[model samples]
Target: MDSSDATPAASAPRDPAAPTALRDEADAVLRGLAGETARLREDQWRAVEALVAEHRRVLVVQRTGWGKSAVYFVATALLRARGAGPTVIVSPLLALMRNQIDSAARAGIRARTINSANIDDWDSIQAEVADGLVDVLLVSPERLNNPDFRDTVLPKLAATCGLLVVDEAHCVSDWGHDFRPDYRRLRTLLGDLPGGVPVLATTATANARVTADVAEQLGTGAENTDALVLRGSLDRESLTLGVLQLPDAAHRLAWLDAHLDELPGSGIIYTLTVAAAEEVTAYLRSRGHTVASYSGRTDDAERQAAEADLLANRVKALVATSALGMGFDKGDLGFVVHLGAPQSPIAYYQQIGRAGRAVERADVLLLPGREDEAIWRYFASLGFPPEDQVRRTLDVLASADRPLSTAALEPRVDLRRNRLELMLKVLDVDGAARRVRGGWTATGQPWRYDTERYARVAQARAHEQQAMRDYVATAGCRLEFLRRQLDDEQAVPCGRCDGCAGPRYDAAVDPGALDAARAALGRPGVEVEPRRMWPTGMTEAGVQLKGRIPADEQASTGRALGRLSDIGWGNRLRPVLAADAGDAPVTDDVFNAVVQVLASWGWERRPAGVVTMASRTHGLLIDSLGARLSEVGRLPFLGRIEYAPGAEPAPARSNSAQRLRALAGAFTVPPGLAAAVAAVDGPILLVDDRVDSGWTVTVAARLLRRAGAAEVLPLVLAVEA
Candidate 1:
């Protein structure tokens, strides 16, 4: 949804305008949308002409800020003037839709949006559309699969729509960096469109392969003869790119604090994760710099306010994650700095494209971190599940007597809830499944795993990650490297990048700023809030518990030295807590940090004893820590909870019900441990190396409480985010 253009205009000779006066009127609308002097570029005019006069499907692959929106706005005006229906645009993000609405208003077009944020207005918006009061209607891709929208409103709109625009068309292809399953629904929508209902798909990041896939999908029938593609060079002359590598998270943050004011105008500071965004925002605010955190976790109302503040320059920068990546436009944004490298250069290009759109110059920098590859691996693990898992999901659905909601089906499957939902969506689009009122149902249609394609896609992702690493280490022009990754025909060395113009920013950090960053990051401990309720459909997994957890059986809100995702202590703790990390005695540094957490934990009553969970991977680490804590706090060291013989549970990636089913009776309260628990005076500190789902601690706590312990305080070295 980047509104910038990277490629130069197509060099093809312009066809003589059959209706010259229509062209003149379109230019007037373009001027109103942009400025009095604004006129459509050659390629932009060509797209408008094709959509208005020829009624052909067109794909435009240009860089950000090249006026892609202008093409659609101008085309909609002309088509509406000719008594065509309102344009129906499928946009990807709420921020993008909001920007499009504002842009449409400038052209005297009454544009309205139907998205998750404004459900109450949908009926009113639809009434207006029925009464012919709207010139354009913007929608998110996810809405295409909504039961009510898909069954009720979409058919009518598709029949009468004037122009169909697929914003961020690259997403329609899985080969693209930000591929989305929801976008694939466009294929069905395109096939259902009334003939001659001009379609326009626009994107700035699609490589050649993605463009081809999207263009093929845009075609009306099995044969792809009706679509026209206009691709351009992706060069952005206004951006000055650079890379800065530092030792660790603290130095990267310290550098930002030291030089944030030196950055020109209001801009963005990008972080790779939500935790890091919050961390950087807090550090910057504590240092007296104006900034706000923006991530998917931020509420919708807050996101809107943050976007407004950024546009008004109320804050110097919005420390953000990829949530702010696509389709939030500020014409004069002046800088973008990445605290950690993204896995793909195409994604990086799209994020940085937000800067330098209408400005004379913009600064773009990447402060690559050592932990970036680990973060990449974590995300990669969430991609398409194995074929056997997919088969399992299908088999469950095929055998169900009624549609099963995701919640109801979760216990029966081994996949995580989110991944399962995504797989179902893809299957729905592929005709092997359907999403109805109740939930998902099998279509009994033929389905193939397409293992070759999936494997190729995985390979592509690995290549992209390597390209990102090369971009950070390259001595050649950074702009050229990114362009080549996108297969931009006009990829060339930009004389303005650090590689071409030499380093533009210094790596030195002020000593005071470094100290403050270190202090903020070195600060330890995150509260591990106990689960208060059981997951639905526990009965399906053979676990009888339901509703609210009994208060007496619940573990008290506990603490961990740090989250594995935290940028500060996270970097230090990951090595010790990693699955392959060898078991060893407690390290002095980690032991002292746990002591600090315990010292600050203002409990109502002190813990009288310590107990360890029997760890399969970290038994030594857990035992050593438990003994050391007991010795230090002068609390008695109780025996460890032992796993029931032959009860090795599977890894806890399954839903709460599935995980609990595997662990319900998996632990035994040995006589010695039970006796020790009865002898305890107060709370017992439950020790473990790490906590993922927290069910392990919950089960063990229940066993201890049943054995006569009054309270359990769960403590861990690390917590998975």
Candidate 2:
């Protein structure tokens, strides 16, 4: 287990007895990785041989809890002992990298990571790797596409790497449930690897189609034409799958409160969104259960500590989003309960697979929510933009004299920050653009926008989503159905799921617990952080604004009655705010909730006047909200900010920068409104149906402030958390 041992040279002569000795050594490594009593399965050895002995590309498609990590760790030990260069692993999640490092140490392979979370140590880690003092280097796939790292460090690693491992390899395929553009860039790394260097791709979730795509990518441009795919049965014999249809979010949380004790030892509780995850974790803790929340919003240090808590069984469960999936090792995890269905069956299978790895039996339950489809649709909306949008971005880059940062590009394009960066990574992979020191630049590589291909990908995603819906409603054996969805060869009825064995868990919730859940969730109010800095390239977008917004023009910290993603009010808001839904006047409950939020809010000063944003589709809704506030609070009612008399209404925008640009000219102070605003000796409350990007509110508040309002305080019916 010492870190000082060096790998033998790849060209070293082999003894007749050396193969047996290496196999024996690998067994010892497995024992160390899985504790002293463990042994490798036959399939695990097959994978190890393909990577270390045969020096061939391998793709391992196995069920979760099948010890996929053991295959790589054991092979790394064998390869390092043979004097090969250190193994390089592209992991998708920080949680995965952390688990890998700890597991590698037990197998006597020294491992280090280079990720955004640990910037202070990256220099030292690279120095150690160059000196051959490290055995395994685990990094996120995003790092592979990082401009500096790609231009400087990648070439050397490709040439000298002993083995290349792509964990969660399904991510490389657009057809995969969790496809990431950065993962697709791995093909470039594979193509550039030295001829003799072996590679391995591993995933628990890929179906037959994704397997083919990933395997082809793994074999790309190599001397080898075919990747050695070692596929295994997807059946997890220890899992008892079931689905509980909950009537509402209140009942769902209440069910957990009533039933946490009935489940076995520590496990995971999965929710579809970050808000749901946090809400569920809080409710569970309030009910005296030991649990922690895991999501993208969780800080690195807190996430690490939460992981440790779950691993050590100090907490009963971790309420998490997909952020906690992929390479998290907990063999004895006793259960996995989903608060809502995942968008696809592959994702569901992969999540539930996290349970029942080491134990004889583990519980897997799904409390399918009525609003799950709405959540899924919202996520689906963020998929790759239409061809014209991509072309618009490329045109901007191609026309620009200098590379522009993402922030600068934001104002020139309609894409949001997250999706914009993702598109750039895809372009970088396709050679349409290149990310460099300054930012991103068009490559002028005669790239054709693949509209047909993208369309087909979109179609495939729709099919996956439909498949997930069927999963929740199926009457057949859930395990067998899930296995078939993954194209498992051993797909057959397990006779242990709720469909086959009858409902295994009661669906009822105590009346008291349900009431308490309703009370907790019904409590509303979320703070909206004010926009401090203007987005870059505002001047180029024809808005003269730049740098930090003037202090006087900024709106104060605002409040929304509730988030659209909340487990409570979110259910009530989704239908009304839906794209196709017609506008309806505010309901009594909604009006009361808004009033309650205002009463509880302790602002520095009370508003003396009310102003409303111009509502195209929700005029009645906005007017009613503004009128009610004015009458109840004893404030003067200022006219709404409206479009200029004959000016064209700008089309609806989907991103902040673009929205701000359009709103800059869309609204003006109606003649009487300016004088009414000048009459206001106190802050004016700016009312809106909802606050999405906060750009509309910001622009409107600035106009009112310029007209003579002392201050602007924003209030909205909902916030898109």
Best model number under TM-score:
1
Off by over 4 Å in 2: 1-19, 646-653
Model 2: per-residue Cα lDDT over 474-541, one tens digit each: 99999998889898876899989999999989998999999999998898777877788877888999
Model 1: lDDT of residue 312: 96
| Candidate 2: 10-residue stretch with minimal lDDT | 1-10
Q: What is the C-alpha lDDT of each candidate?
A: 0.89, 0.86
Q: Write the per-residue lDDT of candidate 1 for residues 1-721, one digit (tens) a residue.
A: 1212423222234455547787788899999898899877767887898789878888998889988899999999999999999999999878878888888888799999999889999999999999999999999898999889999999989889999999999999999999899998888888888877899999999988998898878885423354677888888999999999999999999999999999989999999889889988998999999999999899999999999999999999999999999878998999999999999999999999999999889999999998899899988988888999899889999999999999888878887877888899999999999999999999999999989998999999999999999999999999999999999867899999999999999999889889989999988888998888887888867888788888888899999999888899889989998777888998999999999999999999999999999978889999999999999999999989999999976555676667877888889989999999999799999999888888889988889988999999999998887
lDDT of 2: 0.86
